[model samples]
Target: MTLTQDQRSLLTAIAQPWIDTSEWPLWANVQHQFDMRGQDADAIFHSLPRVGNEVSFASGYGYAAPMRAPIDPGHMVRLTVAGVSKLPRMRIAVGEPFMHTLRHMIDLYTRRPILVDEVPKTILRSGELTAALPKLDPWFVKVLPDLLSYEPAINTGGGAHLSDGSWEREVTRSVMQFRGMHTVEEYIEKTCEIVTKNAAQTAPFTIEEEQPMPTEPERAPYVDLALLDDLQKAAANTHWKVHKLIALCQGLNDAYKAGNPYVCAAMIRAVMDHIPPVFGHKDFKVVANQHTFMTQRTDKIHALKLVDFKDISDDGMHRQIGSSVPVLTMDNIPQPIRLNAMLQELLTILRKEAAIAP
Candidate 1:
């Protein structure tokens, strides 16, 4: 009997344990043993699970037929085992029913689950998985890794207000430090435009004052120290925290590279807001707040110190402050936060003045 192509493949796989390419001598003996039957046998095969009697086999070298289903599509049976002499010699009986069963089984096995896409959603909220996420902030629903919560060093360039509503940007990086002065100037100008464009949303102002307290009692502040402590503990984990800090820092670097001042500020603000109050260390606060002002262009630039914003009444309106505001310096700012201390202190002064207003 002559075997069909599929049958031949199936038979070869079954006979792999005994007869194979390397066992030419054994194969010759098996062929001779089979030739004794005095008939050319034809066999059939399919990419499906197989059942008994329909497939028959014979081998002098103890080649075992595929007794079980192949676990994966990639696995193919070899015609021989490592030590062929120790294995039982075998012969297979191939027939029509085996091919039919295999075809049917393969057809059924090919279909995948219907809801594979929705499977991930089920696992995403699993208790074990949720435990890995950072503790959620009460104010906002975000769980960023702790390391990303740390601040990176940033430098904000200064600019001067023009007669128009626009501000002329001064290169913020050190003069000797700038690789190309003209290019840096252009970048600063672009940054100023981006900041001014978003100024309405991120309105910078000196807090004037709060309305005087009413006689009616306000709610007692419920200081959630326990919650804060838990979040702080989570923030200390290197994998959880460091990754977010690196990602945010990299994002800022990319935004600056893209010449997107607004994006830089927006990204910094996002980070600042995301950080849980638990990790409110001085360095983190300074970095976040400083970067915020820099990106927003709310703070003063040394190069533009002489520009009179009062006379121009242009974009650099903050420079227009009157004598009522004290000269702001490092000494004037609160020691707790140094990033935007001068600007913040100035705002505090302005607030005091406003509070005293009749």
Candidate 2:
């Protein structure tokens, strides 16, 4: 029966505290005491009758093993996360998720099973010459070998270790749909959170191929395209939010040059909220306060200045237009210490994490 993760955990806790519900065997796992493994052997399996429009045909078997699962990582498979598709071939194994792939491999080895043929003898038809004559070793009335009922292994955990278990490891997970990673900022921000709680949690990530990305501008109107620019030089790279960050910076620059102060202000605030995860934090506030690269208390203060600037951008975004407040102008959005300390932090991180082109 299908159970919610919590329900499965509760049942296991009460019925068998030693069991780890999350590691429960799948239907095709051949390591059970009886057949059907962790589920049940005596369970009734059914098949529907088919005969064109009539129910004259009933093609079914008594018992059989379930179809094998496609869990082999040697097979190349691509998965789309937040619109971009990536071949989930664990590129950087830097965290807890990396350990998970290793454990899965060990489990596969520990529970390795064997495959045996279900041999069947030729069938002797009713009142045939062989049946009418002397009897053979046993009853020979049987269908083809394929029609014989399959038997589960007799010994408990009915699988045996293979002699050679040294295949090249292909790291990948069966799950991890990249849920809640809708936006570029969310991708960066959430990746940090997940990696912190989990680790480079991109075990089966990084790009196999990607559409071409734009070159870094000869010069940006305001701040340089920090993390996103370094990322552009890297080969075979893909980040869900790379384009979005570029677009936001472009928008902010265009708004500033065009004297569109409101759009400039909004984009500034958005960029601040978006880019902090590069230095590894959920928001600019934490990044300003805690970035390890910017160790100088004074340089750290400059990072805080970027965070402080976000307040004005916030005002330009959320504050209502009223006569009591003066309208925004180009002078109002003056660059903060030539993009301040955060850019240094960004460059260091992007260089370390991404393989920049020489």
Candidate 3:
């Protein structure tokens, strides 16, 4: 079967690392194996034109040549197009001993759940069935051996020693073994003690026997209207630039309410840009242009030791902003939520400054 993009990616990730660190003796052994088979080992495995210091995997069918170079170390070996074609045969000849290491390395890199169906055809064809079997979920254990077996199907009729009834009994026994040693009741009883012990240990320190249900406080508005009103009044006596800052604050609130955090992040950066002048920095524009100034300002706000707000701001300014893709997505709700909190804290700081302005 033609490999899927994901399967190819996983295979490349597994192979490249192994080839890089493998000793010269391993390649030599592979060369020797191909030579014995009366094959031009170098032409198949190493005939791929080396562009620079790296060696390609010869056949461009499996992986991209330069982008995903198989061999990292500069070396000349017998790896050519024909040798590459015989890779599956070579792996099979090496058997489970070598494939075990490859399987383990693949498992380490691809931490996602692997299925029997997902095992690449190359792995299956490599005669490492036993090594590859355990990589699948335990449910496939009993059946895989039979499936991979080269033995002819037994004829149940014509006085065959292995009758249908005997085969059925064997299959039943194997299924039971696969399901595990304990029955449902036995397993539950065995595990229940540990569960009960853990629950008791983690029970609340002061549980009230008849406590009234606590009502949740009213949901606060994203923008604090009263605080904004106070700041507006306070800013009237200060510089006119604070009005632009206040407008940005309102935009930030609107972005949060609309669930568009990318816009909210832009607004936050805008607010930061406006902040330096308000704090009496003589060369606020010039200082703000420097990357270090932004980090220093973030650090100053973080040093306020506010309630985990620093963490939110730090994550926003550092991690989230640095990401190539937008941080606000269904899979990454926390990033946007954290940014919202950071924005609120920043607005609070600005509001406080406006309130105390001369």
Question: Mind giving the per-residue lDDT tens digits that candidate 2 earns over 116-203?
Answer: 7753222212233233333321122111111111111100111111112111211122112233333333432343343233222212
Tens digits of per-residue lDDT, candidate 3, 182-256, equal 232332232233334433443335665555455332222244433343344444455443456556766666665
Kindly list the per-residue Cα lDDT of model 1 for residues 174-290, writing each as its tens digit.
222222323322323333333344342233344684444343222111111122223223333322332343345445445544444444444444444444232333333343344
Counting only residues 3 or more apart in sequence or on different chains, how many pairs clash (N, Cα, C under 3 Å) in candidate 3? 10
| lDDT accuracy of residue 297 in candidate 3 | 63
What TM-score does candidate 3 reach?
A: 0.24
Give the Cα error of residue 70 in candidate 1, in Å: 67
Cα lDDT listed for each candidate: 0.29, 0.38, 0.36
With a 3 Å backbone cut-off (N, CA, C), the pairs that clash in candidate 2 are 90-203
Candidate 2, superposed: residue stretches over 4 Å from native:
1-220, 225-228, 234-240, 294-298, 336-341, 355-358
Residue 247's lDDT within candidate 1 is: 42
What candidate 1 gets wrong by more than 4 Å, as runs, is: 1-240, 276-358
CA error at residue 20 for candidate 2, angstroms: 55
Regarding TM-score, does 2 or 3 come out ahead? 2
